[model samples]
Target: HEAPSPEEHLQARTSPLRIEPPFCQQTDDFAHNSTLHGISHIFPYERGWIKRCLWVVFFLGSLTFLLFVCVDRIHFYLEYQHVTQLDEISTPAMVFPAVTFCNLNSFRFSRVTRNDLYHAGELLALLNQRYEIRDIHLVEDNVLEALKIKADFHNFKPRPFNMREFYDRTGHDIKDMLLACHFRGTECRPEDFQVVFTRYGKCYTFNAGNEGHTPLITTKGGMGNGLELMLDIQQDEYLPVWGETDETSFEAGIKVQIHSQEEPSFIDQLGFGVAPGFQTFVSCQEQRLIYLPPPWGDCKVTPMDSEFFESYGISACRIDCETRYLVENCNCRMVHMPGDAPYCTPELYKECADPALDFLVERDNDFCVCEMPCNMTRYSKELSFVKIPSKASAKYLAKKYNKSEQYIAENILVLDIFFEALNYETIEQKKAYEVAGLLGDIGGHMGLFIGASILTILELFDYIYEVIFPFSHVVYIGRNHYSKERGQYFTSLRKNCLLICSHIYQMLAL
Candidate 1:
């Protein structure tokens, strides 16, 4: 080798770094003052101060980040668990429909008698003071049959006794008001009733049954002619409950029978769907009830009133052996019935407003599926209301108004279950227990469980520190002489968290 040139020697002496031997790794662990890459070149002795600072920041940041995630996940889990738990334990509630089961049905007469139930137009007038009842349905059945499915009472076995008749034979009218749990179903279903009279309205019903006897059969056919309900109304303002009027006769042509054939078998009509048995009320023809009022005695009967009612061919009055008020055969509007009474009460409306006593609807065993969706009419004139479809969606609404689905579909106003909900307070409870077999809360602590699970997941994250760090740094991870171009560093995440907390406090103060 030739001797080094003078210029090369000069360059070496003037150079700030050595190009030969080991290269210094300044990216990590060493500064440019002393101990550079394990060589005492220009690595800084206090370089560890910066390193320690960075390490501390990174560790704290990562821990803070991880903690925040843990809190968020736990909160989410708790909320979810709460909802799930409620779902798991939910139960449905139901209602009843009748008083007795056996004698009311059986396809056989079973020694039962027929009694015509009449509408007292006066009663409607009385009710109008509180409600804006403009329309009425004209029919021969009880308000129950016209509005909803009938109820059922099992082993109830009520014995009929007329107080007047008893007094004639043994002396004394039934002192106690006949009462019974006349509404019940064998299965878990929705069975309820309602009375449409306005609050504090004066409406009276005729009693057709009594209790305290063994054989429900009328041995001597405890006789009676028909019933007449009386009403004192503002004819020009309020309307009848429901009935028909013949355009020609002006008197609705409702037929009447005196406990004889050619008339609807009152006993036969009793059952779970139509006229419930053991209950004081039963189904009857509107026209039949139109007559049969005693012009003398307690009722102050007026024959002229009968003539005017009869002239319309919609309502009238007649007489019978015992006592009778006047039955207003006229109804404001009439609609068909839907399905038989079910055993469930809807979860809408005030408790007292429940159809169990608030509506005039009657559930029956008739071919409701076919007869449903029937047109609503009054006094033989077509009405705005139409029939409902046999589908459940339709029927469900019908049950709410205590009318047939066929009727509900037509009165779309009531279809908004939420809207109707406001009409009544204390909705009937639905029994989630029977159907879903829910025992307690629907889903047990689902949110808590989910939160716990999220906690577990967070606990398993090994890179949590990095996530919590406020910032990351890159550095070579090899020895002083080794060179790795890039490495990562973590920075404090808690700083940002503290900032957020401080901001929240500021906002609250403001």
Candidate 2:
């Protein structure tokens, strides 16, 4: 071959086909332009090793702090903490709460039939003896003796009895008990009250809103502006057979509960007592509560299959749970419980249902897992009382009712229920750490420490992926066409060698 010139030699040595690794060039460009703090300083040729080391130390310290704080924040968010806040709002008018009242005496002395009395007395005696309650003195000594003989003859096993029918037949009538009624300076009739069954047997609820009637509203507060009632709680008509183990019910009074129109009344458990011979005033404040569900709180939304109640509440859930337990164990339901199961007869009640209910209350209460409702309305009440039938009007009242002053004083009470103010209190529970807040905190820490944003983070990931997995044909050194097998073999060998060297360098650095 002829000797080549100097130009030809230079051109051949610096030919475009002469291959060089592109990774180093690409890395240098990325470092110069990247938004990551200290990256360009680490790679630049002019920076001294000492200055680069200092920058690396500072960047690494900041990154360590950021990581620690971010980890703590993430852990806190996962814990699902909550906060409750209370706020009061004023309103022009507020819906009056439902008022449910029941007589302390569940049955009339003269209204119960002999057979009904005997069966009820036997059941009561069995219950009192079984539960170690007070002695049962419901019937006369002669009747007691006869009951003992009958019990011995039948081995103390009770017969079936209809408790619902008995209660309906002998319970106090609303017409007779509500002697006077007024609402917001207007007269209210007994027909306006709806009948509801509760643990206290028959009870009456005003403004229940169940008969397609809208709830009553009040624009004013204080006594005489809401519901006013003069009730006759006839002490003389109270029968010993109707008393419960709890001595609180033995006193002559009316049990009253203030609740939402959509909720069912649990009178025996939630009611306050209004004693006869007193003018009782109940000042109520409406409260609306909103609670978060699941990961944030234990509150539950009302399910579509809520069968017994129009709305969901803790009290309603408890009642349903108890009813289900009773039906499952005893195959019967109580008079106060709502279900399609047959009413628990006196025999079954004494034998199975009562004990099951007791067990549920005393030991297995946790079995019912009734979570609170997410949104609910509640009433907080403040009560005050003044003695009624003043000395000046005692005689006139006695003459009008055709009863003695003592009898009137012992049998009559005035009840006034009104709002404390035309305002509603809101209680709300909220998440302390939300997803948005978490992301914000993380972003703030990232920017403060590494001088990086979301876009910078994406750019870093893209750079890494491109470096680790380049195109198959990209590893070739020269532009000479080769067989596919040869190209693939060279590509694999170069990639393996680069990865091995990178790993060795990382290990040595560590």
Whose TM-score is greatest here? 2
Candidate 1 residues 1-510, lDDT tens each?
A: 897544454443333323322223332222333221222222444557666666556545555654565565555444322111111111122110112211111111111112101111112221222222224344324433422221122333444433222112221111211111121111111111111111111111122122332211111111121121111111111222342311011111111111211111122122122111111223321111111112111222333332222221111111110001111111111111111222111111112122322222244223111111111111111112222234656657557546554433332221000010111112111222231222112222222222223333344352344333312211211232123222211112244445557767888999
lDDT string for model 2 (30-119, tens) is 899899987888777677989989888998899899999899999999999999999999999989999999998777755755456446
lDDT of each: 0.23, 0.79
Each prediction's TM-score versus the true structure: 0.18, 0.82
> Once model 2 is optimally superposed onto the true structure by TM-score, how far is the C-alpha of residue 438 displaced, in angstroms?
1.1
Number of the top lDDT candidate: 2
Ten-residue stretch with the least lDDT total in model 1: 414-423
Count clashing residue pairs per candidate: 149, 0
